[model samples]
Target: MVSSTISLAPFFSLSPSASQSQPPSPFAFRRGLFLVCHAFSQSESQADKPNSWRQLHWKEKRPRRKANAISDQEVVHQFDQLLAAKNLYQINQYLKDHAKTSNNSYPTVFSLFTRLTQAEGIGPDEYTYAILMDCCARMNQVNLMFGFLGRFLKEGHSANNAMIFSPILKGLCWEKRTGEAATIVLYKMAKLGCIPGIVSYNIIINGLCKNDEIDKAMDFVDVMMSKGHEPNVVTYNTLIDGLCKKGEIDKALDFVDVMISKGHGPNVVTYSTLIDGLCKEGEIDKAMDIVDVMISKGYDPDVITYSILINGLCKEGEIDKAMDIVDVMISRGHDPDVVTYSTLIDGLCKEGEIDKARNFVDVMISKGLEPDVVTYSTLIDGLCKKGEIDKAMDIVDVMISRGHDPDVVTYNTLIDGLCKKGETDKARDFVDVMISKGLEPNVVTYSTLIDGLCKKGETDNARDFVDVMISKGLEPNVVTYNILIDGLCKKGEIQKAIDIVDVMITKGHEPDVVTYSTLIDGLCKKGEIEKAMDFLDVMISKGLEPDVVTYNTLIDGLCKKGETDKARDFVDVMISKGLEPDVVTHNTLIDGLCKKGQTEQAFNFLDVMISKGCDPDVITYNTLITGLCKNGEIDKALDFVDVMISKGHEPNVVTYSTLIDGLCKKGEIKRALNFLDVMISKGHEPDVVTYGTLIDGLCEKGEITKAKELFYEMISKGVDPDAVI
Candidate 1:
């Protein structure tokens, strides 16, 4: 009602493919029903019914009752009785008696009914075979469906009939046989005189779209138009959905205009697909803009649309804003499903707001939405991260008690937590537990366990686990190799790590940045700087450009070796590669410069940092203060601390302690004690290092009484003194 129109083509016909030979009774019942229906169309006037009935099977005149003489229930009851008794003859009679609307919705039951008949050696009726096609679709038994269709056609039913072709065509589509489905719709159906109607068209188009053959699907739309079939609303919706899924939102919107022009209204599904696509593409604002348009079109956004937006916002760390949308969603009469609540809970947990996340879980339950495996996993994962493994285990118990099976993710979370806390034996035990529970360990499971074993210096056991993973038919991915390599490097088994890299590359598992980085760092730590550079060159040749971590590792190694000039040159090379220098890069450089007595050069670089819009953080200032103090520029260091404070950088205990130790080293006891007083007044809590510095200064000055007094003060404050004190 709102737009323009497109032309429909002529309904092209094909020659009948059936042979002249008489077919068996399988087709007899089917052919009779269709012939009867065709002879007397539904659009025919009721007054012509009696005459139409007399023409059935070309029989002589007989007393004829009105069509649909028996009720649907009576026919169903008759069929049920016949089927239950396994009466083949009566069932045959029953099928022949009621080829009507009464049995339409119940045709799905024919698969089981026919199988029951098969037990009694009774062959299925034609309609039974049709339903069996559907049964195969349900079971994803594509080949069996084709076999059934072949028998149906051999029994002499016209294969070209839209009724005959539709089931298998739809079944093929259901099984994701998009290319095969297209073959049938384009060639086989055309040869059989069966031009696909909108239903079959939509099925193939949907299959094509799902297979990411949207371009081909669009080409099919043109073919349909050429065949005089105007693209219907379902047709257009499928195309739009396909485009949206392909991340071509602009194209999808343009297609909507085409749809509107065709006078085929965009339905809820059409707009919802667009909204979901937008959210996934991280275009939430545009998605909301489309939502407004959808609502303005008198189409109310359903739960799916709202949930998509909720999840989108959550992923973007817009939890408060997402909750606001959730309120709006509820007020708009859409209930938040488990997915929506799970997404929100996950977002909150990621932000380290565990308590807030747990409260939301309660609210979700109060709304009658049961927490699914994903929800429990999210909560358990959050608790584990916060080092509350006991609470996490309690949730695992609750998850089981609530009848939700703990999935791989759940166990993975527990395993990861145990690994981080160095309770790896427990992590090892959980693997067996998961297997006992009938849950297969995925790549993540094996990788995590291997990493844990590697961390505990159980590399041999980690290797055995990798074998166990392979034996269980799991392929170790690049990350699994990287973990092993890193472990080897840490244990000073650099050759073993390099061998793993070689094996990975030989196995066609191209080494990624982590793999190369781990090897480079290992070689660098071994003082094989030349080898590390060779690997860097190899990595570049392979087009794996080194990231900032790569540069940082190299620079740190060079600085540690007192090769400050080489490290500085490496930093310039790193910058040339389009990698920005991070704080770690700056800190490493400052430490190197200060050690080389280039403290002024380090301070000059600080100006360069500010000029480049890099705010000098506490670590930045701490390094500078340490550097200045080391170079015997104690007053300059004190002035730098003021500058750090003026720049709004809070001086940590390390900052103050560095200065105190400097003054103490210079035998400036009174000055050091004064600085300690200023540190205490500035709300800085003294650590053992801080107290030890002051104590050592007093003891060195032969002020044993004052040192003893300070030691007791440290003990009273619960700060333990060093052995030196």
Candidate 2:
């Protein structure tokens, strides 16, 4: 009896290209071959007599001319179909035969599985268990991947499965799951007797640094060095990039120096990362210095490097310097990219140079670079900033014409611009358009509209907008309340403003400085000075520092109350706290003192104001002179008048009136007449009060005839005298 076997190579001899390119009818040939093999196997029996018909049939079926030539393409195609339909059960069944009979080689099937896992929305299942673990590792699902690893081990799978551990660790590092990834990597490496490569260690260290676990990353570096694993340029660059991103630019530079000392040269990526960080931090000069360093080291700054610097300078309001950088880049044969152009346009627009920004857009188009949405948005914002609403709308129209549907930002910019120009109705219309386009109005949009309404003195409408905002699921921020408070205060609705403040606090929103100051100023302006003081006390108790405007309002209110002593004490308290009182604070106190007949005290404050490094303005001296004359300290008042003259402050009508009123009160009518002559000589016309005071003094001296003559003279001079005087 002869031993027999069957070959399936003849069926596979048909080329895949021929099968794919031709009709479906050729598939019948392959199906017929399978049927013939099945029939032959069914008819034959293993136990048979020598030279039996079954043995002859088996011998004829074995090998023939096409044995040992079967490819695994058909098996791979079936596996793909199963994987595509996510039929993991069928895949496991097929894999069982392929695993045992095919020398365990399934590269084609495994490759197909790898591609499927990489597809967006496709994921891994249990039958492709090893592949699923790899996918989990790639996606940084370390815990899930490790959990699967444990199940795989418990199911008595081979230890060669440990090969999946490194890739998993790498995935963890990439996903910034560093600490956990590192721990697992180290433990598994030890358990499997595997040593992590430099790339693996570098990845772990990079992740640690990114997480701001720099110390751990550095410790790992030290451990790697101790274990004789040399750190490469990539290792140093990773550390540098991480440090720069965390705003540790100086430390990053120091790392560069250390890298140089360790014979590892810094690469363009290292410099670019540092420059980008510096630019973002508003250290543009430092970033430029790094750019020079890169150039001197024979590294041409890339588009990103220049963009960073340009953006940094633009943000810092150094548009001219940013333009200079652009010129240098162009001069160095580097064509400005869209980002570079957008930065300049944004900076110019922000600086109120909309025309210049438009010119740049023309230049960008001439250079053959089509402006993107960012470019359009930047120009729109620029136009808005320059108050060029029509032009901005044109840009939006053009953007739409170019088939670039305006995003929420574009609408937001226009709405904000309209609101700023007090076009709340138009802004609201745009808001409706935004919602109609399926874009939800965010907090900024509502806040801008509310603020615009409040500015127009439409507090009720502003409050209504607030309700609309809340109904739309948007929470009002601190700014919303501040605007309402301001509006209510301006309308003399101080109590309502206070009620809003209470509501704000109840809603868990802490009252900011603006909140307290708005209410305080409103109270002070309404002559509710005591209530404002109570608010100040509450503000201080809440740990909020009163700003200079807060102090000024309080001092002005106290001055109005004729409480100069208390006002001065508040000024002293402000000074002791290192809060310098402004000229208004001094003027209020001096006017209060002069009104209270404390002319000498008022004069002293004038000098105190000068000594406190606040120059006495015309108001300061005028208030003091008026206070002194009202108190019958005419001589001292005259001296202040001279001081004001010497200080180049021209004496106006109030100055002459104070002098004339003071002299008349002292019975020095003739001298008052002399002062009036001098006043007119200096081209200072005597007002009605000046004439009235002198006329009243003449009447007191039995010169009624002279008083009547002066009264007629006052009418002739066009000075309307108050009837009481």
lDDT, candidate 1, 1-725, per-residue tens: 00012111111112134233322344443343233233223212211111121132123222233434666466557666676787766665455444332323223244335444445545575666655555445434454455555556665666555655666777677667776777777677776566677777778888889889898899888887887788998998889889988999999999999999989888889988898889879999998998899999999999878877887888788899899999999999888987788878888988888999999989988998888767888899889898889999999999999887776668888999999888888998998998798667778888998998899888888888989998987788899999999999988899998888888888679999999999999988998888888999999999998999998999988888889889989889988988788888888888888888889889887777778777879988988888888878899999988899898988888888999999998899889888888889989988999888888888889999999999999999999776776
Total backbone collisions for each predicted model: 1, 0
Question: Candidate 2: misplaced stretches above 4 Å?
Answer: 1-259, 262-264, 273-286, 543-725
- Top candidate, metric TM-score: 1
| Cα lDDT tens digits for candidate 2, 193-280 | 4566676678788778877888788899987787678889999988888888788888999999899998998888888888988987
Question: Best by lDDT, which number?
Answer: 1
